[model samples]
Target: MPVTTQSWVVTQRLPDLLFAADARDEPISLTAADYRALHWAWSEAIGDYTRRTVTKPGDKLVAFAAIAELFQRTWRAEYLAGLWRPTLLQDLLWATNYEGRAPRPERYRAPSWSWAAVDGHVVASLLDDWLGAGVGTAVQRCEVLECEVVPATPLLPLGKVLSGTLRLRAAMVKATWDPDAQLPVLYAALDRLEEATLTSPPATSPAPELTQIGCAYPDSTEDACEIWAVPVLWNKAEKYAAGLVITPAATEGVYRRVGCFHSPEPDEDPGRLVWMLEQKKQEIIII
Candidate 1:
């Protein structure tokens, strides 16, 4: 038998790597790259915690309250359910990962835009990383006019949410369902392009051969009918985008987030998303 060495090792870098960049006494102030690493650590924790199977499904936000409280001291920012206010736009970019996931709870939890609203693994968008890397400059498409979250227990504000809503002004476009792929299609958006072409003809006739612009990862495929695509951030230089997929709520002008979608994935074209953004801008509420 080969000589075996008996040794004990202490991995000091284990937890340090996670919280080293985070601020303790003072708020975190670092270079763009370092700040992004800090955000990644927090996002990873949220992603892992959301995937866990719990005895009380309603305790989703409650379970993570301590962690949120801890970060609150350092972040010094308002906590909007599962997301933070400072980076709310990027935080809105989370999407449900339905692989081996259970159905959402019947009881009310958080709003549809929040990760706590769903029961499954979720991934936060990499838009911050992409921006920090200087890949492209981001032009915010959605203006977060107002946001509010009501807590179940006034004493434990961060524990459980009663109701939440976001008032926004963004470009909203209707999408049709694709029965074959079980996804939403932007067939109507092309009409805008035709209208623009007719009004102001370009030097060359622009014929866009696009059937499906980008992917729409809906929270519930069964209830994703009559959906709309709302592009939040558009990186024109790099040709990439990210936005929310929403459906109309019971209220006349109110909508609810069903899921989120990003562009330039595989064969998808970002130009189509750019076209979608040019359609029209409207002020709407999401709850």
Candidate 2:
């Protein structure tokens, strides 16, 4: 003799339950552990839910919750919990506030530098304030040693990223934090100074050139940051040579990509920038 349940009543409560799924008593920081979990989740989920599908500002949270539910039974409980942490949720919302239509990778997936790579919350370094004048060569060249991914399925958005590796020939320099910018700033000495001209127009002045770029480290919460700025050929025709920024992880010789930094200034020929960096290219891996 059990009471019969009403379908309408259950339907009415569904929205409330979904919205309440992420309620928390306190905020949580995006720790190294959290970042690792996030990276894995993103690699698996982004293919199913393209960044282009996110239309509204609030859609990101809704999408995140849905993805978390899909992985609830498979992933560790702690890893799923990190996704809903109040601070992390807020950061995701802030980072996804792009004005125009999001960029979609022409290939099967999003590019590594794209937020689409990991459609989750992102937080910059908290210690960027103390950054002052700095000098040193950080990363000279990079090679994608290996990249592998499993095909996607109905339940899984992106199959699974089996293993990925990057080989970098870097100088490795301690970075300074720029508090105002809330990101680590690195001043790296560029190789082949004459090559720098490839990215810029005919020189108007002989100014001492330095590649000043912002860097992010996935798992690090340290004030004294170590970063590498590896040149990438983002667009050959536009002559766009982007800085694929990365930072070391706990494992020796292992690095996690932070993001890419490109100069805002217009370049007439971006292909030269790619050529300049390609001089050191060894191998390319499609992720």
Candidate 3:
């Protein structure tokens, strides 16, 4: 038998050799092309990693910082910071596909209202002005009682949040879901005076059509008819508002978010509207 070689190893850098460029002629400053490449890489990484990570609302900022660090050479600190708000909002609204059909996690991570609780890619409107341009301030205040995250390691890019508490100064009203329409319906016979106050001189015409709004649930299987809708503004100038849909949790007096109601014309004060609808006011909520 021919003598076998004790050991043999080979390695090749074909990609580097094939794609090598003249370093002397390379541009000194980063260009738009460089930025685009960096952004694409970062986005791809986030899309893949977030799908497998268990995220929480309170951990959003920290997660963003970690991702930014990976691309620091290509982006400025201020530019990265500016991306936070919109990213948070986008994650909250469209984090999961078939949201209604998604199963609820047995162990609590983030409140149902937060996008971080869901699993999937988050999408947002490109034209949305996240700097509070058309946004309204419906939430008067927020208090955090506790927020903790697991220590991150090389294997876990996103640390799991242990537990959290959040208190909100909001207004809530009773409502029910219309399965046929896949939206929560709030029926309030529009009072002539209220209609006149909210709308322009269409007084001569039919009373403003029953104020119908689009509503969505964080978990579609929620079957509580005695649901509460809390007013949260998405846009003030445009008279848009989103109602944080809530239901009673296992712990009495503690409410959990289930969905949201989008009102294109929330011209009326939410508190007053609740009163008009003959529903009790829920001033402070803890979750």
Candidate 4:
């Protein structure tokens, strides 16, 4: 084994700044640049921490309680499972970083919407390089109506969660399985995603010419013949939208997130897909 002396001046600055910002007594409204920087820092921390191999898969959230506590105190915001409440919508858009990934464990860890629900490297899609560069803004298209995360230990809200529920008011439409669909991005919710075909026809026409506008990256590899798409963010300039793919739970109108869907509607006019989605907006709960 060889010991190497490394320069640490540059590496120390990030944490120094992070803690300094956290030490503030009051939360300050951040500018676009500040927000980008903050988002980047949190994204890196989350991605780095979750990617590490752990002896017990169930210890995911439990192991990160310390960081979560710091985040809660700093932002003075609600912590939902593995995401922050202030940016819950954007945070819910995390996806797997590789293909042919393993299926989720049978034992419950976290809600399907949370990255802690699955094993592997998951990246926050909204915090990608494009957002950092400010190329196109991610317009939030959904609203989180209600959220609840019951911790196993009542004294430790940031510790292991017994259960969670996320309810949203957003545009949702049925998506059928399409094995022949192509994936537009390398990092998706799952390694092998089934093509998502819209079951409902577009408002513009009685019959839609193109049904394969997106793909569903499920949380698990189990067979799913049908799912639902709920649009979360839209970048009108880029003709792109990112959202969740869900399936109905035991209770009607309630669903479980099976995966995430990324739709790049380059062929359709900007806002056209959004318009279609708006027509089908409704409230649904995810557990």
Q: How much does candidate 3 score in TM-score?
A: 0.49
User: Looking at candidate 1, what is the lDDT of residue 99?
Assistant: 61
**Candidate number that wins on lDDT, 1 or 2:** 1
Per-residue lDDT of 97-143 in model 2, one digit per residue for the tens? Answer: 22222333223232243343444333321211111012112222244
True lDDT of residue 266, candidate 2: 39
TM-score of each: 0.79, 0.35, 0.49, 0.76
Model 4 C-alpha RMSD vs. true structure (Å) is 8.2
Q: If ranked by lDDT, best first, what sequence of candidates would result?
A: 1, 4, 3, 2
Selected candidate, larger lDDT, 2 vs 3: 3
Best by TM-score: 1
**Regions more than 4 Å wrong, model 3:** 1-95, 124-158, 179-213, 234-236, 265-283
Error of 2 at 100 (Å): 18
Q: In candidate 1, which residue pairs clash? A: none
lDDT of 4 by residue, 164-226 (tens): 999888877666664223332212222122344588543542333334546556655655556
All predictions: root-mean-square deviation over Cα? Answer: 8.0, 16.8, 12.1, 8.2
lDDT value, candidate 2, whole model: 0.35
* Model 2 misplacement above 4 A: 1-145, 149-186, 191-209, 213-224, 267-279, 282-287
List candidate 1 stretches off by more than 4 Å. 1-31, 126-133, 178-189, 192-210, 266-274
Give candidate 4 regions above 4 Å deviation.
1-14, 21-32, 126-140, 178-210, 265-271
Q: Which of candidates 3 and 4 is the stronger one according to TM-score?
A: 4
The lDDT values for all models are 0.68, 0.35, 0.42, 0.65
